[model samples]
Target chain A: MIKHKALLTLFLSLFAVSGLFAAKPVPPAKKAAPPAPAVITGLTAVDMPYDAGNAAILKWAVNPADAADTFYVVYVSSLEAGGWLEADRFVSSAKTGKDVELPFWAWDGSSLEHAVKVELNNTYGDTLPGSVFQFKVAAEKNKQVIAESMPVSVTPVGNWFRLDRMNNLVLLITIIVIFFWAVSHAKRKGLFIRRIAGLDAIDEAIGRATEMGKPIFYVPGIGSMSSISTIASAFILGEVSKKVAQYDSQIKVPHYDPVVMTVCKEVVKQSYMEAGRPDSYREDINQFVSADQFSYAASVDGMISREKPAACFYMGYFMAESLLLAEVGATSGAIQIAGTDVEHQLPFFFTACDYTLIGEELYAAGAYLSREPMLVSALKVQDFGKLFVMISVFFGMICVVLGAKFGWSAFVSSVLNLFQNF
Target chain B: MKLIKKQIPLAIVFITGVLTLISYYVPHKVSVDYIETMNKWENIVVAFAFLLGLISLFFSHYHKITRKADGWGYSIFVFIGFLAMVVPSYTSHGKQMVDGMLTPLGWSYKYIYTALSGTMFAVLAFYIVSTAYRSFRIKSAQAFVLFVAAFILILGKVPLGQIIWDYALGWTGQGVSAVIEWIMQVPAVAGKRGIMIGISIGAIVTSLKIIFGIEKQYMGKD
Candidate 1:
């Protein structure tokens, strides 16, 4: 009886411990399938012009909290039969945030650049069709999406106009206006401009050569005659040739362009005929040295040295060659009268030559020398325009100063914008 | 009769001017058509005019070469160079021929042209040195001022300037850059503005004369 009781007690204790340890493992509550990513919102499309090779920009809003413990995904499709084929698909961790522009190149071209848009999703589960996107604002604490935002459709419209092109509009208008005004003014009465000092100096220069019995060396610039300024130079050459003919002085016209040489020959011949000294004109009056800038300079320099001309006229467009020619003329003790619109070379000519016509003065030389009334009137109108500009500038400056002191920033800014547009 | 000759060209000028002005304001289909026509005609005229210069170039040089004038060899070289550039150009349409032909020829031109031209100019440096040694001999206050200005300008532009005046050339906050900017802005701008104002006034007076038919130089004769 004692042995049986001991065995029974041990069995009971073992059963009690087993029962205490055998509590069942708790099963997880069945999870509901994640809803599709709260429909995407804030879709935008813009056309980019610079890189038309093949591309566009797309952007959308994302929110992650709405679809329980879900990630966000994006999808895109064409408007054509290929309904929403994934152009580019990507997954996102957040459901409510800004995303960079994604590209969609399905129908991109010069015409169809801004025609694509995108859709977004928050569902981590399998996707279904015929579903509209509704974006939800994410809830705090658990970062759960609370309510969906109105879905935005992506519209592919590339940037409508270029920013750089807008900047050029005013400049283009100004150039056109200036050009037309001058041309019209010239047509009305013909241009009669004042006598440029350099042109005036030309007569004196050639006369001095006649008196001195020294040759007159004329360098008709180192550029082609087709250049407008060079044509202007050639016109001046006609006047110079007439004077040379009348004065019975020898003229040496060295050139760089073969075309310019022919034009120069014609101009000189015509001027001699007009001056009633056609018999005095010679082929040597117009000669081509070289098309090379420095070579021409060197050759001219040699001529200046050997011929020892009494008067040297450096007229036309010059570069570094200006200084070289000026220095040689200086060495040869020639009375140099230089006319050029090359602004950079002006200072060198100012330093070395007896007279130097500044930029634009060369263009004025024909009008001034010939007293072309049309040229003069165009210049007057240009002056009026300049006066208008100055008045506007002065008034604008005053307004700016007053505005700054009185704290009228908005008014000043608007005025500035207007001026900028003007 | 006088007005007919003078006024018509003026009328043409004014009409063209007004048309261009109207063009800027109007964005209508007619305006667009006019602009396109103008651009097309301009391009066509420019294309035709370009031939004048080219023909003149060939004729003038060919005459020189045929007559065996001074520098006839240079004329031949120029003709050959012109043909070399032109022949290959008319042969091809795009970058392919340019890559195969123009590039090589351009390279050769650069070598021959640059070297010959550069050597001719490099001789000037010696001439300048000698000229300076003689011409720059101190003569007057004006001459002295000129000399000093030239010296400063030339030295300031060169690499050795900073070497001589370390503090002057140093990239520190207070240095030559600040001074240079000040010089460019203050005196340079002032001088440029003054010159511009004078030029404007002169131009205005000239234009007035031109419009009144008081100036006749561009008309070929009195």
Candidate 2:
């Protein structure tokens, strides 16, 4: 009986061990090999248009099955055989061809493909014209590269014309033709320009300074020689200084830029010579105050307060310091004239200044003050340009409205594209 | 001498101006290189001009001090301030900070220069208030319009303004902020765009005048 019981226990123990072995979980069938991530297709490399042969645009069609996290790594090489260096990496959905900035006339951008502008100069220091470059793109998922595109090559060459800016070129040419026509016409028949009160008040301001026996202060507001407003101010200063010289009145020109100061000195000297009072032209008329904006304003303000100049002229580019200088001049009982192209600061000038040149008036001041045939013709050309723009805007509005109402998308887009800068 | 001073500069201006205009249309490598080189040259020229400016500043103050001009005492402060900053710069080898602590140069910039600049900037607030007072006095039809626009603009920007707007004009089913947006986007933008268009056309004409040598006032010739 004991032997039979022992045999049963041994059989049960063996059965239990077998059951444990049977219940063990199997390895997850090796994840079904992860489905082999889809590869990008139809890769093409072309030299970027409207560029200096230093960039190439790579485009490729992406498979719809690509995961959102799937990344594309762009590799570039001077040699086709090897030495592939990673140029850029981006997620699958990052860049599409539609995101390109080129106009429709230059590029046929499609939403179905990826596009990238690879700057060759960034990779190879300098990319000479007609230099061959090879590129490859690898699609990666879960940190593993799934597939690579066939190596595509491009020979970047500089283009002669930027087709993208064709509209701008056309407009520029039109303006130039108008300018030449206006110049010839002006010489034959003088152009008519409306009175600018600010420019008209120049003689008044200068005469007041002469009457008071106080110096005239000209603050060429904190702009470099390159600024158009500063150039205008220099011209006005020439005319004013000539008048000052004739009247034997003192004038002080506080400069913010050294180059402008240098230029203004020549202008004042010439004006004095023109007025036949060269002996009275002082070298200290033009002085460099400070390069720092507020410091210059403070120094000018202090001078205006102390010297009690009869008239003050603030012209050129001014920031917040506009009010600081203008208010001080106003408080000093000086007749102040201010002009700037900065639209936001116009209100401050209008409030504080006795005469304020708004927008184009500032540019027109030089021409108006000089009344030269050639200079006045430029103003007429500008007016013609304005008329052209007004007509274009009016016609553009009509066309856009008609196109939208009639479902003429192509016409609307063309009109809109003509107005677009790029 | 005429060739050197007048004709050469005019020729240079004509050549460079035309080339710059052409470069705007052309994307060729040579054109790009020319623009880059020209910009670098401009920076170098500006640096030398800065040196010239420093010399002029020194001479102007020096003359004032020597002559015992009206503000001779103030002129002495200019030299003192210039040396105070420049001496520390040379001694510290142009390092503003050393081991995360301010050097003498840095201290001067922070404690003295920036503080003075900030004080000057702070004074602008009072100036703005005075300007606004004079501007919003309802002197004419234009002034009335400006007053109304400015009042709306200022009122829509603050929390208290929004609360007052909600209580007063909320019945219109649009917020005061919406009115402000319309004023800014429609009327203000229209006026601004008009001015901008005129300015742009003027600028272009001026550029052409310079390029063609029609306007030589900058050359001080008439």
Candidate 3:
């Protein structure tokens, strides 16, 4: 009975200890699904600016606290399809607010390029031109979407006009109007234009050729009529050929292209006729040279060495052969006058040629030589356009300096924005 | 006859020029499509004009040969070369293989034409030296300035400049190169940009003149 009592006592003590320490195993705490991400706020869509049309812009703001480091995927759905397709995706960690353009049109021949990286600022491209598109943004975390933005809708249309380029359009119209006015003004009378020594020396060179009884050489360059330099050179050639005809001096023109050769032949002939010396218009004056670059330069150099022309005219679009021709002329001691719209070759011509017309000076030669009000007016308008650019740059620079000096950050930024938009 | 000579070309120029201007600002599908079509047409036209150039070449050489022109000997070589290449071209179309290699025409182009062109380009090296000698002569204030700039530019291009600056002049590293860079980047670029602005304005004026028919010398009527 005493042993039984002792066992009972031990069992009672064990039960008391169990009551103090033992417990039921708690079920594993359910992993709480990430709290639904805050909805995208202030989502709106508008037509994209300054493009050939069929584009939309979507803008939205995300509470930085809600979607701080989540990857957000943007989905676009057309109204007819009624199903969302992935258009672009971005990570909210890179940006909290967004202004995105939806590319909605494509040209027939050109393929549009699109970028989807969140950090890369890019355009939306390759959407159909005439469709309404709906866009939604979804925030993703840990391989599960936690939040979604309400869908925004927009219809892209081909605008007849681009409003963002309005400033440029106005500039164009103003220039045109000024050109017309100047043309009319000059038609009534004459205008004062600066005399270019390179152009004026053309007459002197022709006179020297006449005195020497030697031929004058003209290189019409390698480019064809499609090149502006070639056409302008041809015009100047016409004017100079007229003077040459009047002086009864022979002029040799070697061509590099067939169409340019044909055009030049006619121009020389017409100039001869206009100068009342049609019989003097020799067909051989403008001869066809090899289309090969170095070959033509060598041929011309050979001619220069053999004939020893008194005057040489290198005009139009020249290339690697520019220095070769000019150097040959220098050795021959020919009165070389070079004119071209090519900037890279200008230094070479300037060095070797006695007279060099640099860049726009070549374009201005025709206007100066012809002195027709129509051409002269173009010159006047060109000066005016330069004046506009100069003024704009000057005012912008002043604003920048003043803004920096006085610490007017707002004024500085506004001016900078204006310049950028322009 | 009047339409062909003047009106048609002018109308085409005006319409196409205005359309191109419009396309720059407006990205409409019709405008884009028109531009693409025109670009293709331009390429086609250029290709056809190549034939015209070849025909003219034949006549030019023929006329010279018949007349026993001063360079008549060279004319024969040109004809021979032209025919030699043309015959092989027609036979091979530049793709036919010969001896497990490129065709004879391709071989001629690669070995003969390319080598000759490269040789011609290499000759410029000697020409530049001679030209530089004549050009660097200090005759005037402007020329003196140009000569100095040219010297600096030449010095900066080679490592000898750095060696001379560091050893002889007791200067630090990149001394000559830094000055040259500043000159090229600041003064040279500024001058170049000014010239570019002038060129752009001139191009605009000339293009406008052509579109409006004010510049007709190119049309062979002036």
Best by DockQ: 2
Clashing pairs in 2: none
lDDT of 3 by residue, A1-422 (tens): 99999999999999998987887678999999875646667666655554545556556664555555567777777676577777666666543222222211211111121222221012234545337777777877765887787888776656666555555577778888888888898898887788899999999999999999999999989987778889889999999999999999999998888778878888999899899999999777887777889878877887898789999999999999998888888889899999888888888899889999987888888889988877887888888888988998899999999999999975876565454433
Top TM-score prediction, candidate number: 2
Question: Compared with the true structure, what per-residue lDDT tens digits does model 1 show for residues B51-78?
Answer: 6545655676788688987666766876
DockQ (Cα-based) for each candidate: 0.16, 0.60, 0.45
| Top-lDDT candidate index | 2
How far in Å is the alpha carbon of B15 misplaced in model 1? Answer: 7.0
TM-score of 1: 0.57
Residue lDDT tens for model 1, A57-130 = 44444443333444332333433322433343233443222222211211222221112323222221223232
Error of 3 at B215 (Å): 2.2
What are the Cα lDDT values of the candidates?
0.61, 0.89, 0.78
Query: Which stretches of model 1 miss by more than 4 angstroms?
Result: A1-197, A222-228, A256-267, A282-284, A287-292, A295-306, A372-396, A410-422, B1-111, B121-149, B154-177, B193-219
Report how closely model 1 matches the true complex, as a DockQ value.
0.16
lDDT of 1 at B166: 56
Error of 2 at B40 (Å): 2.7
Q: Model 3 TM-score?
A: 0.80
Model 3 CA deviation exceeding 4 Å by range? A1-47, A53-56, A62-156, A287-306, A405-422, B1-4, B96-100, B167-174, B220-222
lDDT of 3: 0.78
Tens-digit per-residue lDDT, A1-422, candidate 2: 99999999999999999999899787676655565458778999998988878889999996788888899999998754358878889998877887788777878888799999998777666633337789999999888998899999998888999999998988999999888999999999999988888888989988999999999999889888889888888888888899899999999998889998989999999999999999999888999898999889999999999999999999888998999999999899999999998889898999999999987888888889989988998888888888999999999999999999999986887788888897
User: Where does the lowest 10-residue lDDT sum fall in candidate 3 chain A?
Assistant: A104-113
lDDT of 3 by residue, B83-117 (tens): 77778888887664777888878877887777877
What ranges in model 2 sit over 4 Å off? A1-39, A62-73, A78-97, A111-113, A121-131, A140-146
